[model samples]
Target: MNTKKQTGIHTGLPKLLLIALSLLTFTVIMTACANTKSAFPDSEGKIKITATIGMITDVVKQVGGDHVSVVGLMKAGVDPHLYKASQGDISKLDHADIIFYNGLHLEGKMVEILEQMAKKKPVAAVSANIDHSLLRAGDEKMGTEYDPHIWFDVRNWMKATEAIRDVLIEHDPDHAEDYKNNAEAYLKQLEQLHQEITEKIASIPESSRVLVTAHDAFGYFGDAYGIKVMGLQGISTASEAGTKDVTSLRDFLVESKVKAVFIESSVPRKAIDAVIQGAKEKGHELKIGGELFSDAMGEDGTTEGTYIGMVRHNVDTIVHALK
Candidate 1:
């Protein structure tokens, strides 16, 4: 496979794992059901919602609460832009009442599949509620018709939360009030998060307020915090940081005396190290600030495993590094 093809192919591993887990869970439940006919009363069926990635799945669970069971199609550390659904995923989708995805092209190769599924069932683009003006122009980057990483900004993510609530209400109208209340609560939390991040970023010295990363995943974040951000690649995971992008960033870092550059949890670090090495060649050394949760959240069973925790950890890391 070609370089881009290889990247795309590997991205499906997470989805495959999720699909497998869902199938396993389903099988276990079915076996239990077969053994006991009257073990539990089955009068009402719960709504099943599936998301393309963990972050979206997290929000859906928060909003849907006990009325819905949410599944994240992508596993931790997987890139949603390159994920492909497996046969197991098809089975999971076949049974889902409603599905949610981070649209605006974040689900790369899976976009078309999701679209086809939408025609047959209820599948809403959670990111559709995001204002177009707020979206970053991904025109300059390859395969990025428009940047789809709005979730980077807590405020922008409120839009996603609202969209999720709307979709849930549409499908499960009996629990409309519940979804609204949950969405409101989540939105309040997100607003508080936005304020906290602004304060934390503001604590950094003005001269040192630069966010450099493996991919252009922080445009929304940079816009929110007044920090100058640069990414080696475009919004699309398919775009690699070529020699030219690295050379330019290195020159800028050395000239500006940038203290630290960050690597992302999901993206490879080779490109970031190359930037640091390039700066070193120019007689300046830049430290690795910290790993940021860019396209994916941290591993399970960690504080950074949740959306709130991930944002807090990133803020803490950046403030400590740049301040």
Candidate 2:
């Protein structure tokens, strides 16, 4: 799940390794030869972009059209909470014309490296302009940072899409017209998708609107579509689900008669399985609703590969299970 962070859990690299990575980033910044931004307007080739997650990569590709070539560091089912960039990913960041990522501590372990690179290049977080009031506040255990699952809220993602379009226009002014046209078309599609999701969710019986999943990744989704969401784990998979947590959730399902529980593609299924067993012991026959794309989108070339596709899949899956 490339859209979250955690504390007191798996930091991708040990403390010593992170220090070395910081030093290496500084050295790369100092020695970097190309200033992609200065040369961007005149460059005949596609703008080379390195994005941290597939969602951002898709945005860049869509807005930049034929003008940009983008690569995402995190792939399908790769949890960004635990992702550590390799030497190759560092090289990609160093060589890119511009870099984009989800901020709000989503890519926790890569923070230092990204900051080091931003000193020399155009590195932007797509959620840079989201109002603080719009974000879901985190609890003390997760610190005071806002939740990073902004994409689950279609409105926030539309803002992010516009941000990507504007950045591409600013950096590659020659393609401003194309970028503008592409963004307008894409934003319209997103508007339609948002409406579709809203109406579809409204069809589910109000009493069956609870969505149980492996983690709290769908908090934004739940808020946006009027669903009551419960997770076995906290916001980040870095924390483990204890017996007490499972028992409590199980008791809720039994009491509420919740129809189904979902498994996340990026999270482990063991916790979900335990919850199901607990529910069964209490006489609730909860079905596994469907595997939802929470932290990571589906694989490339599939319907779930695109951001729109992923959202549609989640909503449709939820509607089927709950209805």
TM-score of each: 0.85, 0.86
lDDT of 2 by residue, 1-323 (tens): 44445542356558868899999998877655344433233445788889998888887878888888788889999998778999878878887879999987888889999999999989988997788899997644755378888899999999999889888889999989999999999999899999999999999999999999998888898999899988888887777899999989999999998879999999999989998898898878989999999989999999899999999999999999899
Best candidate according to lDDT: 2
Model 1: weakest 10-residue lDDT segment is 35-44
Residue pairs that clash (backbone atoms under 3 angstroms), model 1: none
The lDDT for every candidate, in the order shown, is 0.83, 0.87
Can you give the lDDT of residue 78 in candidate 1?
87
What TM-score would candidate 2 get against the native?
0.86
Segments of candidate 1 deviating more than 4 angstroms:
1-44
- Candidate 1 versus truth, CA RMSD in Å, comes to 13.6
What TM-score does candidate 1 reach? 0.85
